[model samples]
Target: MRKALTLIGTGLAAALALTACGGSDSTPSADATLDPANPTTITVGATPVPQGRILEFVDENLAKDAGIDLDIKEFTDYQTPNIALSDGSLDANYFQHLAFFDQQVADKGYDFEHGEGIHIEPYAGFSSKHQSVDDIPEGATVAVTNDPGNQPRALKMLEAEGLLAGIEDDSAALTLTDEQNPKGLKFEENQPEILVQLIDDPKVDLAIINGNFILDAGLNTDDAVIVESAENNPYANFLAWKAGDDNPAIAKLEELLHSPDVKKFIEETWPNGDVFPAF
Candidate 1:
C-alpha cells in the first residue's frame, strides 16, 4: 500500500531568471541552499502528455511529504527542455529517452545526467487512410519525424514492416536508397509534432508519430498500422538534471518517480499499454 502524504505550504520564495526556455518567468535558483527538512520547489520542464502528467501525479500525491515541490512546466518541442536546463531556467527536466538524450549531449554538449527508465511510450505508425500495413499501396507517401533521435526509429520500424531496407544503424541521415525502397514509397520528413497533423493529410499514406504526440492527439495505439514492441524497447523516458548539481530535492523527486505508487498510477492510467513502466 502506498502512503498518503501531507501537503506543506513552504512559502519559500523562488528566484527570477530571464525566459531562456519559454517557460516560467521565475525559477528556483540552482545555487540556493535546500534544507532537507523543509519542502523545496524544483522547476522542471516536460512534454505535456505522459511526462508532464506523470510529474503532476508526483506533485499532487507524493512531493509534499518527501520535502519537495515540483513546479512542472509543459513544453511542446523537444529542444527547449534541455536548453532550459542547460541555461539555468529549469532545475531539471523529464522528457527525452536515452537515445535522444545521448544525441543532445553529443551535439549540444549538455552536462546532464539521467535516472533509470520510468516508462516507455512505444513508437507507432498511424494512418488515417490505410486500415493496416498490408493495405498500404505501392508508391505510397509516408510522413516521418525529421529529428535525428527518432527518424531512425521510424526508419527501423519501416524496415521491420518490410517496407524498406539497408538501414545499417540508427542514423538521422538514413534514407531509402535505390534497393532499399522497393515499392518506390515517397518520404516526407517533418518535426514530430507536425507528423501528427500529416496523418490525416490526403497526400500522406502513413505517418510514423512519436508516442507523446499520439496521446496528445487522443489517438490510440490500437489504431496504429505498425507499432513498435514495448518489450526491450530502448526509448524509456526518464528524469534528467545538470551534472555536478547535487540538489537533494531533485534526488527525492527522482526516487518518488520510481516508487511503487508511480508504477501503479501508470498501470491504472494507461491500461491499454500505451505507456509501459520500464522499472
Candidate 2:
C-alpha cells in the first residue's frame, strides 16, 4: 500500500469492462497470461490507494526478480474487483478485508477465496458535534455506512461506547437489537462514499467511516473519537482469487506482497499510520 487515496472524489473510475490483461514483455514468449512456466503477467484489480500503489511497487521492484509480471487494473468501487475476478476478467484482486470477503460470498454466493492477508485500513468514528464518546447526548442522530460489510462495525463502536450492549451477532443490525439502548440514539445509514456528508449534517452526532472515506475527505486521524485497533483486527485486507487456486504466478505474487520489504515500506511510507501491515 503506497498512496493514501485520491481517486474517491476525483470522478475518475477505471472501466471494469476492460479485460484484466496488461502490459507486454520484451521476451517474445512472455505475455499477460497465466503461463506459469514462463515469465507471465498476472492481472489484479484494486482500488488506487495502497492496493494499486502496492501492485505498482511490486511490478517495478519485485515481480521481475520472482519471474512474474504484475498487471495492475484499478477500480473505483469495492464490488467490481470481485465481479471482474469471478468473470475471469481479472486473475486476482486485492482490496477488501476478510469480513467483506465473507459478506460477499454469503450475500452473492461468489466462488472466491482470499489468498494472503496484506494490510489493515483502520475504521474510525468521526464526529463534528462530539469530541468524545462521553460528550454524546441521548437521542442523538448517528450515521453509519450502509454497506453490508461495514455497517455492523459502526454499530459495534456505538455498542462499546455504552449506547447499547449485548451485541452477540456481527451480522445483526442495531435496529433489531432487543437489549437496553441507554442513549436512545437514532441511526442514519448511507453509502460509505457519502458518509463524509453526514459530518456537516446538523442532526448527526456521530459518523462512523471507513479508512477510504476518511482519506478521501481529508479528515484528521487525531479527530476520530474512536479508531479501530490493530491488535487481532479481523479486517485486514487480502488478495482474493477464484476457487481452485493452482496458479503458480499467483503464488509468486503473494510471496512478493507479504515480503519484509513491503512491511518496511508500509511503516515508513505511512508513518502517521493511515495503513499498517497486517501480515
Candidate 3:
C-alpha cells in the first residue's frame, strides 16, 4: 500500500510539471508578422479647435480600423506643437499650414516635413455691431491679425471686399506694406484670437478672424460679413512630422485622411463650405 501511494504521488507531480511546461510554451509569440519592439502607439499633437477634433475622429474611427493606437495631445498655443514634434515627443502634428510650417523651419531651424493636405479653413471678416460690409463707415476701425502669416491673409480678404485696393501681390509672406490701401480704413493689428473680443469694443468696426479662432469664439462661418475665397488659397492645413520619418503609420494616416470617411466628415461638419478638403 505504501509503495502504491508513493507511485501515485510521483505520477501527479510529473503531470503538473508537464502542464507548467505546456503553459509556458503555448503563450502566443509576439505576433511574428508585427515588429515586436515597435508597438502601434503613436502620439499626435493638435490644437483644441477643429484640428484636435478632427484627430479625435481619426483616433476613434480610423486608427482601430488600421490596427494602430493613436494618442492625442492638445495644445492651446501655436508654437508648442512644432516644438514637441521636433523634440520627438510627438509623432506628428496637425494644426499648421504650409506657410506657417515653412516659417517655423526658417525661423527656428526645426527639421519637419508635411504629410497629406488636410483642409482649408477660410479666414473671414466679421462684425458684431454691423450687419454687412457696406455698413462699415469711412474711417471705421478694422482689426486685423498681427501675426506675419495671417496679416497678409486679412489684408487680402479686405481688398477682396473693395474696402481696400491694390493687393495683386498677396502671398503668405506679403506684409501690409506690399499693398496700397486707399479706403483710409484704420488698421488695428492685434492677435487673431483676440479679434473677436475687440469686436465688442466701440472702436472696432470690423474684425478679421481666422477660422479656428472664429469657431473658438462661438461664431459660425456663414455669419461672417465677408470670407476668404477657397478657390486658390494655398494656405491649407497639413499633417507635419520630422523630416525623414515617413513610416508606415504616416502612410496609413494619409490614406485615412484622403478616404471618403474623412471627406464626408468634413462636408457634414463644415457645411457652408468653410472647410475645403485638399484630398
Model number with the top TM-score: 1
Better of 1 and 3 by TM-score: 1
- Against the hidden reference, what TM-scores do the models get? 0.85, 0.82, 0.80
Candidate 1 on 1-279: residue-level lDDT in tens? 112222212121122122321121121223335554677988988888898889889889988777788888777788778777887878888888887888777666777888778999988998889898889998999998888877888887888899887775564433557687888888888878889989889999999989999899999999899999876788899888877667878877788889999999999999999998999
Please give the TM-score that candidate 2 achieves against the real structure.
0.82
Candidate 2 wrong stretches, greater than 4 Å: 1-38, 178-180
When superposed on Cα atoms, how far off is each prediction in RMSD? Answer: 8.0, 6.8, 18.3
Better of 2 and 3 by lDDT: 2
| Clash count (model 1, backbone only) | 0
Kindly indicate the candidate among 1 and 2 with the higher lDDT: 1
Clash pairs detected, candidate 3:
none
lDDT per residue as tens, model 3, 105-208: 76566767676578889998888779988898877888887666557677778888888766643333223342465556788887565677887788888888
Candidate 2 lDDT by residue in tens digits, 1-279: 232232333222233233332211111222355443566777888877777877888888877767788778877667767777767878888988876778777766676766667888788888888888889888888888777787766666667667777654464454644454666777788777778788878889888887866765677567898787777877888887776656778777877788998988888876777789988
Structural RMSD, model 1:
8.0
Q: How many clashes in each candidate?
A: 0, 1, 0
Best by lDDT: 1
Q: What are the lDDT figures for the candidates, one per model?
A: 0.79, 0.72, 0.69
